[model samples]
Target chain A: MQQNNIAIKVNGLSKNFDISESGKGFSGKLKALFHRKRKIITAVDGIDFEIKRGEFVGYVGENGAGKSTTIKMLTGILVPTSGSAEVNGIIPFKERKKNAAKIGVVFGQRTQLWWDLPVRESFDLLRVIFRVSQSDFNSQMKKLDQVLDLNSLMSMPVRKLSLGQRMRCDIAASLVHNPPVLFLDEPTIGLDVLAKESIRNFLAEINREEGTTIILTTHDMNDIEHLCKRLIILEDGKIVYDGETELLKQKFVHEKVLEVEFHDDGNVIQGIPGVTVIREQGCKKWLTFDNDNYGIGEVIGTIASRYKIKDISVNEPSVESIIRNIYNNRVTLAMPSEKSPTK
Target chain B: MESIKIYIMLFTTSIKARMEYKVSFLFYIFAILSFYAGQFGLLFILLNRFHEIKGWSMGEMVFLYSLQAFAFGFTNLIFSQLVNFDKMIVDGEFDRVLVRPLSPLGQVIFSKFEVSTAAHLIIGFTALYFGSRYANIEWTFYKIILFPVIIMGGVMIAGGIRLMVTAVAFWTLRNRSLVHTVIFSSKEFINYPINIYNVGMQFFLTFIFPIAFINFYPAHFFLDRSGSGLLHPSLEMGTPIVGIIVITVSIFSWKAGVNHYQSTGS
Candidate 1:
């Protein structure tokens, strides 16, 4: 029964937080000491998804869309109020230590390393904690050092390293035990372009070579487009979009922008059938056309007949715009009702 | 075995981290020494004036005081990380511990083991040595064996108390006042014989909170004044047993808190 392939399976998982309404000012705080208003905030509302082993899934959502709440549940840090979550076929919350042994987690906001010790020493401590054999630890370290370029950072105290260096070391540390599943939450949050690329490459390499299941959550659209083949978008604690990344681009309200340079007076060009002129420069006009309705050759022909010959370039919708479109129209999109929403 | 290895590794690594700031580490030692010296000075002044507190002599008082200090100092060295555990919960940093393949409580205890308690140990040992010499108490071989057992038991009791208080934060989220009064401020009450306080207060300290077992009750066995304290003369032997019971109850309390957190997470 293909049970072993399911790295993570979540069913009807929900978490509701009770936020006490405390009033402002001294008297309000004093009054709150006696009694405070309580409101229940549903963080994750009955989400269901099954991620197969070796799947690279991007868990994208707006702030407060329950990305972290869901991650905590899957990581066994938070018990979902209702429903169940199984990691590697074991209920995570019921068996945190066992689950932890099989999963590696990285939080970009925090470092799990010992702050004052050398980075290399922290890895050894982790080795001891996870009960990895000496040979396995060495082999893992060799692989990590090669991918992460951790040679220079290993000897330095963790606090002395730059954020980027520390992050790379963090990722490498998490993978030391060779966990079958890795969860990364904004692993490239504050890193520069090169650092982010390095991390992305490392992640991609690890997923490919080791067949590690990765569940990544990030605000960075590049992380999604470049690394993740599958994307799961959450809106207001509900699954708004979940499927192939390419399919997401194709299905969303994404339009192709054609930038045309005029050989003659481009200002004279006025109308085109079913095309919106989004931007107009002195000699260039940027027109957006629905890719589904119009082919690029057809659009170019329409513009070619109307205007003088010119150089033209067509632009596909960027991943950022596609994700933005999803978030903007998430509520209006046909919501996933009480049924399996795993596309 | 794995837990012990991990604990030692964590403890040593943290100590190594502390050594990185040599001047700061020395300052910690100096500060603790000065602070304990002042506490002992206060005790010295009070005992000099009163001479005897409810039939217990000055040397006897110092023995009790040192015992309390010893128990607290050792326990604090190990469990000082637990002092601000409420803050850890409030800041949502405890999630890091939860995700680890170890007991959250054990991780907290081992990873943050404090080195600043060395000065307290020095002060406690010095006071105990002098107190025993001055009091001229006959030391037996079995008495020597029971000495460490009594201290370890007392430490367990204090550690249990700390664990319970810190675990309370899982519900309240912010209860520094309770932690402060119950853990730190209450240490002053056990500096002298518990019998000096009113019988009601003595009973409360003995039965309800049990800070008396840490030193006052156990000290009676050494001071040859077992029957005079309160309740039962044989209660002096109850330190280790009471420790096991208290720690068991507190561990249960800690588990309950973790369950509550799992159900209603921060």
Candidate 2:
């Protein structure tokens, strides 16, 4: 029943919670004793997807978007209300202990290390918990040290370490057991740019070198841009988009700003087929165009051939704004053209 | 067997962590021992002033108090996490336990081993040492052999109560007040002989919660006194069985509570 290439298979997985609806004040409380109100909230709607082995996929959603709930079900921290999921050919909730041995999880908000003990002691304890052989534990530590630079940090108590330092140690702690699959929930959240870059690079290297399957959920667009080649975007407890990470940027983030400064004020250029003048002050005009439909160079060539010589520059819209736009619009990006980017 | 080894390892780590704060640990032991001593002094004064209650002397009352204290202390030392399960649930540590490659119940129970409560044993045995002399209890083979079994059974009963209280947290995530009320009320009721209470109250403690079997009814059987005929004194033979039954029911409730558990906010 186990498939070799499928690292994860999620079929119509869902989770629902029953929350009590209680009234405020003493009279309301007394009156409600006879009739208790309750409401059911579907945190994770029926969603389906499969991840292949050695795939580094980014799962992105806003707060209260059911990202954490889905991870909890996959990690066996919470049982699903309906449907089913398998990680590495094992039903995670049914065979939690066995599945736990094959997966590594890192929660950015909390460290897995023992609070009062030194970092080395925490790893030693985990070695016993996971039953890692002594040689394997040493080799794993060596490998983690290469990327994480954990040698200097191993002696310090976890509570005394800085957040970034503790995060690095936490990531290393999760990998000591050499689990085949890793789940990271906001792994780079609340870290400085430098720290975030290092973590991203380390994750990329692990995925490339070790062939470990990683499922990451993060709100940071930079993390998705740098590390994730594929993405699954969730909204309102359902998958809104699932495709190559670059496709999202190309389709939704294709708008580029072209600012043209003409040599003479008399020369007023008319619009091209795909270019629209968004702002004009004096001889300078800022035109916006979809790069996917019409090449930036083609539009600039048409303007230059018609008018006097001018200086021009193009600016691609930041990925942050494009993602924000998509989230606000709640529309899947429909590629209007099949042509690739033209210089 | 592997789980037992891991439990010891976890307990050792807990002890090492507590040892990091040596002064506080020692002070806690001293404070608890002194607190028990103060309670003993207060009860000594009460029994001396009243002379006797229901034909039971001060020594018999001391024996009852000390026996329950020892059992409660032993259970509290090993299984205190069950009493404090609300905090773990509220802080989201229970989720961490589930992700580990071990039984959640084993990890939670053994995660917190309170070496500080060793003072309870010292106080209990000290009380017994002094109380047995005053009560003029005869040393015999049967009495000596059964003493350990009775103490262990009483401990299981205390642990069972703690487990039952912890199970309530699955529905009410932070029921600190409710848990403390149940634990403290039952502890208060067990310090005195069941004969002092009325018949209905006796039945309530015996059948409803079975707090009476922890020490009171056993004391009646050991002291060679005929109970009020409501329940037979020979029922003391089933103290171990009562402890076993109570623990089994508590475990079932705990499992059901775990199944019903919905983890808190992310």
In terms of TM-score, which candidate is strongest? 1
Q: DockQ, in order, for the candidates?
A: 0.56, 0.71
- Taking chain A of candidate 2, what TM-score results? 0.87
Best-fitting candidate, measured by lDDT? 1
**Candidate 2 displacement at residue A18 in angstroms:** 1.6
A266-305 per-residue lDDT for model 2 (tens digits): 7655657887888888888888987777776788889888
Candidate 1 lDDT tens digits, A1-343: 7999899999999988878878799999889878988889999999999999999999999998999889999998887889999999889888989999999999888898988889989998999999999999998889888888898888999999999999999999888889999999889999999999999999999999999999999999999999999999998899977899987666664468899898765366566766888887778888898666667789899888877866999887777887786677752456423332122
Fraction of reference contacts reproduced per prediction?
Answer: 0.62, 0.58
After best superposition, candidate 2 residue A126: deviation in angstroms? 1.1
